[model samples]
Target chain A: MGLNLDYKAELDNIIRDHIDMEGPLLPVLHAVMARFSHIPKDAIPIIARKLNLSSAEVSGVVSFYHDFKKEKVGRHKVQICRSEACQAMGSRELEVHAKKSLKVDFGESTNDDLIFLEPVYCLGNCACSPSVRIDDEIHARVTPSGFDKLISDLRSVNHHKARNS
Target chain B: MRKLFIPNDTSAVAMGSNLVANRFEELIKNKSLDIQIIRNGSRGMFWLEPLVEFESDFKRFGFQSVDLSEVESILEFICDDSFDAALNKHPKFLGETESIEYFKKQQRLSFFRSGLGDPLCIDHYSSLEGFTGLKKALEMQPQQIVDEVKNSGLRGRGGAAFPTGIKWQTVLDTAHSKKYIVCNADEGDSGTFADRLLMESDPYQLIEGMIIAGLAVNANQGYIYLRSEYPFAHATLNTAISRCYAEGILGQNVLGKKICFELEVRLGAGAYICGEETSLLESLEGKRGLVRSKPPLPAIEGLFGCPTVVNNVLTLGAISTILCKGSDYYKNYGTGRSRGTLPVQLSGNIKRGGLIEIPFGISLREIVEDFGGGTFSGNPVKAIQVGGPLGAFVDRDKWDTPMDYEAFSAINSMIGHGGIVVFDDQINMFDQARFAMEFCAIESCGKCTPCRIGSTRGLEVLDKISSKKDVEDNLILLEELCDTMEHSSLCAMGGMTPFPVKSAVELYKEDFT
Candidate 1:
């Protein structure tokens, strides 16, 4: 069941911590994603073996959920809420501007890997429609220009970090 | 020495409270002022957020949108001798926290302690009548507890409007040694913030209510399936749950009584369907959030194929008040079967968008006009969606309709989660209807054909209609698709996606043309 040597210890501990619980697949999967930022395909066989579920069963749960990404996301995940509330506030226009500025679609990341654009159903800030969540922080009342400026800020930060490195 | 408060509620954070809180703390230290800043949950008044409130002689007064540069000035003003006069003159100052007309008008039964105190502090919570409901429940028998709820006429605020007592009674009557109480906190509804507010502002209230529910249903284990989008609520709830355990309110022999209840929180993975109780249970079990077929309702066979009482956040949050105030007191508020206060969330293109907890019989016009202050765009509100994404697109003519389950149901609409999303005249109903289909297509679990396929087809038809490609024929086809999806779907996810589409076409007939 060995796939790769990377994160083997973290994967084993995650499996050990949750393997005893009923319906342990999702918890173990969340833990793996938390550590790796995205669920590694190699870890699936190890989880499947430990949980005694088939590899397909484990991967099925992972792929079914939007939160579980197969690859690493950008440094900052920018999620624009696309629900009806936001749509009423011109979120469709915001989305177009966001994608064009970021040079990425809803689930894609930038070439520089500075920003990842994602679509969220609702952040429960419908009062401030056209809301955007950068990492865990929410930015409200965002127009197309506001979104572009936000992207510029994120890119500048990434540029500074890259320069330092 | 004085105390100040800043909201850590997600909405407030969105409006720059995090920076405000940081800057205020730094300025207080730099100026050597004897002031403490507490990051509290939002007061549900969003328009004037990053609202900084300070305690002066036991009466709290506040300033709205406290900026980084203004922190020092506000600190000096608060530390001044004529604080009251200064507050009166300050344009941003909202005289008294409790006396604001917006906060004063509404009856805040479920949200009694929200945005008023440190959510994690047990002392502050208890002082605000937090555990009064649980204390009463601790003394009563299980059936008596259920009976009290039954008499209160509290229905599920999660949009189903099912009687809360009957759902509890089913789990109570069911013979199972290991039953569970699961709270559905996965509030994905576009206009809903009531659940998020309660969870973040007063986490212990939900904990107390869940503990009371556990006592009522004879269940010792409880799980709250919270949405992943609400990271603030997640952290707050976890801390509050730990506090409950440490305070002897949640472990074996709760408060030295024979009751033992252990609480846990599971996160939903960004799926709208998980808001459905059956799908919530599925997600709680660490699986795909696919809606389970009913008849074996979540009450009969829920989480892990055992008897489980699944209640929404507001439903459980209301338990404490119901227990403390008696069922009759709660039943006295609203009209007919829809008893008690409904936390109606007014949002989306709204001037005064926030959580309004009122009696169920309040008219849509009053909520949208009087309380909401009309559209933010200054245009006439063309349509108001009373429920969530799946709710009907109600026209302006229906403004005077009483927002009750029955009244709304009669008009092909629902008070689903009591969230009203206002759309101004600039909105195109046809486009909105198309979005309803597209959203369903994107979020549907792909378990059923009606929701999975029908939603996509619905979008295509809407596109055809919008482009004027055989408009008459496309309209007929779209209507037929809506009917098929409504009738043939496996769950409400499939069944209700057609609601917005059909209602739009019906009410704004000109939009389609």
Candidate 2:
């Protein structure tokens, strides 16, 4: 986990890039999170100082949103739609299956750190109910078997990469 | 060379449209055939997505729900000597995509170019009378532009039925050198995807609309507050925005008119309340999305305390149509006070789910049964939750009511964002009521007491009713709590949550017992 990265220099660059924009804090945090899997604790004070806000205010915003993760998550983030449309198409069962198959509940990463499951409200693909987003790709009409195949395929790819390395 | 159209829209991609498109590319490569594959936006017939269309001789025919196996057969069918004979022989053939009963019935105004060709192609957009609206707007005065929208009778399509022209007029009249035009692209309502569809399918339409709005209000800056859930729309918008800058459609000289306007997309951090204008502004400022009070409306002092013209994606998207084809042409389509077309999204356990851009005043029954084609499970239609989560769970008796603002209000329901989520006979009304309260609690923003705390109490009361513990008293307490939230809560999040709960209890009394 120790990569000997320069946190202060990277934070300064992220803050500097977005500082001129109208609403710079969210974009800065988003850029930071994109660079580092999560918003590191030390980066908050730096962001607050750069944006001319207090540390409490910065952390308040970071804590308010569900998207801004404070800690690192699994390599692949898997989101399941739990909104009414998905529920109408039997996503409750899919949710149950996802949890059972992944061996973890919502907001928890798998023991192997392969996948992180989270309950998303909606993905705007209501027409194709029971939608799931794995990494960046969203899959519609996801059944238990469909989800299993996706996870297994992801795992197999990871395994192949590990073996080759 | 014949062209093959496959949708690259979110819904289509979810249904394996990408794989189908890639497979076609591979097959064309292997066979050395003279074919073109165009990734267009969805036609909104989502149930038949991955809908492959072949265009030859200026006619477009479709193949519904095309998987890898069907792709091979489609290639064979298109290569036949005669299209009619080949289409007749094929099992998946859906004759002329435009003539399909679902697409034909819809009166498309804003979505005219959807699924026609590449959404990003400026030439394709131009061929279909795309920037004609902005061209028309350039010659007119600010008041003239505002008057045209007012005459069109276009209301805020993002749930509130407030007139769009009036909102713009307020911003235009307000003395501010640095006003802003914010497009609310946060389409968080569960049963809705219209905003997403407009942004993804006809992005230029939205860009054109924003530019028109900027011209109308004399505002030079705009921001599209997009939700994090819509990654696809985000990508499409960034591409479109940059393209506009490169093409001289946006920036210091818009369309070479010496007018200046700049637009940028700001992403929301998974907060449903941000769909509310005030919350959206707060989020744009890089703060927690807390709702601001109303006395100073967004049009007067918004986005860093400057006058802002905040309109929904569809509301702004409609501006292009209103400007392009005079207000009279746009106004002639719908009934009563609700003039112009509404992009209605039909979803959730529906047999034929998609986007139906029809005029207002059509009954819920028509939209749910006629356009939706009833339940996906082939079960009896028991309940329909029109207008997203805050909307009421209307029963069969209420389905006949016309789907306009006043008519729905008369029946204790609302056409919020035009999202209709259907449920079959198997749905439990009581459970839905509980879920409504739970959702409200989770997304309240914690600025007010009723929404923040009352939703939790409402959930507990419903739980007590479920457990059969003094049901009558608990029901009375629940009604009182709903009354408090309705009367005093900060915004619609708490104010209108009672709409669904009260309607469900009143309509389905048996479920309560």
Candidate 3:
């Protein structure tokens, strides 16, 4: 988040570390995303040149994968399992509830850019069903109300942080 | 002072294990009770999650699904100490862990350590005969180790049911100076969580298995190609690996032996097709997760063109057990070709949904009704998908069929990754069939036209049929398209997509037309 628009040096360092790898494009792109939550638009050409690939090739690789984001997203990323396993357990209702609670659809962030909702296939917790991933932690068997509580907890954590700061 | 064992497994956590853990900790501290709480892996009885077990008469006594609200009352009886009979009187108490009927029926050879102890702690793992496999492996010749696995009949648990030892043998005999062992942890299966459970709950077993695999194939380096979705598994595995390295079970010289084995976890960027070995190899190489045509097979040319041995987490996870427990012990359980225990995951609308490690030859009826306790909603069961997304759908008549690779294959289906997803009578088989095609279209690597074009076309046909636009003709065309995809696709992603679609149509044609 601290990095600016000119992240060429940071980008090069990531590319350099993985360029010697057999197929370096994916790893390098992964590294960039790991460092900065989303890969910046400008980093594509830089990655392409280092990997000796065209900008289109680099962009295609990034866009093909669902994990990669083309642009910035909200601070607190919320993902609901959209796979059949969760769907069988009424995740369709959970998804609708999450969207309404966040006041944002699947790809949209909140007005204050606090929470972003996305659909993930399976969180590998099929038994619990209706799983939700808030940032890096996955919560299982989530209901619409349960999802609301988690969001409220996140908002309150931020509220407390702001007041203290 | 008493000890309590509560699961910190992913599914357990999802079912309010954390809240219960926190509450238990706070209550014990407030009461100044000297009770120790251990966050063990799930017992695989998900319906009884947040399940708490305490030491009583030198055995672990149980409390099934202890909610956070009941943490105080449960602690109240426990804080009095002396293994109180009053605490045992709690309604949730299931007497002892060993007495539970669901766990009693399981043939827990490979999963012996899972859901029983702390995964991250070396002591927790070692306390339960952990490094004995690796320790035994270090003394035996590489061929001996391979023979042990071969004798045990451990097939790849990553859905293919390929002989894991044979895959190891090919790499062992390849005569390459540099070889690699890769654990395909991509687990994209909709209903499967056994791999995730093993990796997260008892990661050391997988690490131990990989180290043994490295030793068997004469390979020094290993990689676990994990999917990005399982952040918890990734974190647990990484931590466990670091712990293993510190414990001297891994790194430059395993257990102070001259042989060296190192392991790393590589994250796969959201691609379901990457579960295929070559695609996983491609993804690991930092390329697009595209399926590669097999000629040289991955055991010959894999992972930067090295002679690589790729096995699923379950396959590798079984290695340590086979070596430690002896091959015959492992072989004694399973029936026919599907030897050794299968950690079958019961999920999706199941009542007592969890992991059940039964030997081969168990009937679907036994698994679904007996172990799983039937549908969660108490609704009548309709169809059950025996594998992942690409696996076939079985109608009600087939519930009596045994679960094994050979048996499933006999019915034009396979127990892919050993995940059985239950669907209630409320399900629309037509939509499920359409979903199979849609899933394939979304995940097709575009390297082959049969999978890529056929999938999209299949979806179109299904849409037309669902809309009642010449339904009879559309079904015939869909059947033809499915045949084309099954015969012509480069990999299982395309080839096997027809299994679910065709099975759905055959079983529930009335629902469609």
Candidate 4:
């Protein structure tokens, strides 16, 4: 499939603005991934050529870090804290609940392209326990029922925004 | 007019301050009481958050976890001083936070204004001795500023106990016109929350410290590379920066001086390795949070090819205090070479899981038994991890070791981020050791070979040892791999992963063999 023009422009700008012009190809690739929702597979060669790095080197860097993604993500990304602090606060159960509710495993996007689920380390809100972030908004002390409500609410909001647009 | 400061921190809100705040506002409107309520950050008495402080005759009276339903009663008591025992809405623990032993024992240099002043307001910070350091720093040469910090003996609280003054001096000496100050706020250590508390409670202190660093180092721009996990902190810090800019605490010619200092918060996507300085820089530059090879240390060439002084949040937070209170005053608290108070975060299977700032040289025994009040499991304490997941697991036999950097290092352990996690007899040392390697394997940035593959191999060897498959052979192999990783890895994630694994194996040989 052809790349989205706006998305490509935005990604290029992010790469140019954030990543270094030379040396250490991994960080640049990582930066690209961080800016764009995902690292477009086609951009790998472009990034490699800019950094004077091998395509294998770029791919190696991209695949090494778990946070890097190769494909586009959903509109809303839900990251659940699976670190020890959250684990102590029953995140294991919450993780299971999230998987069942979302009908996808960690690092997987929903079929509807609404929400993508991922595992995060400590959110620094350990005192509250079981913290989850939906894009920029962090929710704490999330129960299974609360998780369901949160996902549904987010989905509905996404739908509303979609319709509005 | 009575001035009241109600903490708006999440910890405070979790303890039900939002409802209380609304009620206080309602009562003021209803009674037409001459009162102004300012929502500030908490004062570290986490158990007593939703802490309401009422200023009377320049003295602040505190009420913890004040319920909204009790607001009217509290107002009546405050207004009348009537002997309505039932109506007196005092917290479970009454009196000023300073009087509490948990707080009183702490010297609180770094966290001096935290939980006491409005984090987002520069006025509150200035009123509480914030910019005094920046003013002092600007008056002197960069070398003088560096000398003062060196005299204070303040070490990097970001795991490595390298002297802060030396680092600053090195960065100063390094020739680069476009120098940068990067504050490592990606505090992902499981047992640590000092950075988070500082960010949420007293963000201005961090800003002031950064401004001072910028002025001293002749840097124009800075970035606080905070973890994406801390959404609240991100918002709080952003608010603080805007306020600082408006108040001339940040931006060009800060405090009407020729010095120019600007700060921005860069959020790192979920990556534990970013806690490492090089990895943090990489992440800040919008790359994967991967470790970078040293020799061109961040001080010489860092953050988009500039001389950047990358410091831990606490290390920078402590700088303002050192400058404000004088190096001698700051250094007088701790023993040995480890000067000044350290904000030790007590967490994980401990009764009192919170932040406590105590003088260096305080024994781990005091922290575990006295401050922590022992393990939360109520079982006898067996082993405790002094640092984060990467730190060593010290058996109770070594509990008397002083919390100073020298002492911890002497005991084959480094106080990485001052995170102490207690574990009872129920904890299996073998399993804990395995978990450490597993954690490293999972979080390694894969920049270096030893860290990337060695961690996974270490885990496999640990599995062999744990399963008792030629346990002796596996144990030797584990040690060999740990040594290789320790000597070869680019960053501490690989260097220190061996600490817990090796320490666990050494301390509790019976568990593995």
The clash numbers for all candidates, in the given order, read 0, 0, 0, 6
lDDT of 4 by residue, B267-370 (tens): 66567898889888876665667778787889988999799999999999988998998999988988898888888887655665567888988899998788
What does TM-score give for chain A of every model? Answer: 0.89, 0.94, 0.91, 0.84
- CAPRI-style quality class for the chain A–B interface of candidate 4: acceptable
Global lDDT for candidate 1? 0.88
Better of 3 and 4 by TM-score: 3
Per-residue lDDT of model 3, residues B315-411, tens digit only: 9888888888899998998889989888899888889888999999999999999988888889988888989898898867778889888988888
In model 1, the runs with Cα more than 4 Å from the true position are A1-3, A160-165
Least well predicted 10-residue stretch by lDDT in candidate 3 chain B = B76-85
lDDT of every model, 2 decimals: 0.88, 0.92, 0.86, 0.79
Clashing residue pairs in candidate 4 are A30-B287, A30-B288, A31-B286, A31-B287, B42-B115, B43-B115
* Top-scoring candidate (TM-score): 2
Please report, as a residue range, the 10-residue window in candidate 4 chain B with the lowest summed lDDT.
B83-92
For candidate 3, give the lDDT of residue B341.
89
Can you give the lDDT of residue B331 in candidate 3?
Answer: 93
Proportion of native contacts in model 4? 0.18
Superior by lDDT: candidate 2 or candidate 3: 2
lDDT of 1 by residue, B36-73 (tens): 88878788988778888999879889898777777877
* Residue A31 lDDT in candidate 2: 93
Score every model by TM-score: 0.97, 0.98, 0.96, 0.86
Off by over 4 Å in 4: A5-68, A72-77, A85-103, A109-115, A127-131, A134-165, B13-35, B63-80, B83-93, B286-289, B377-382, B424-430, B465-468, B507-513
Question: What lDDT would candidate 3 get against the real structure?
Answer: 0.86
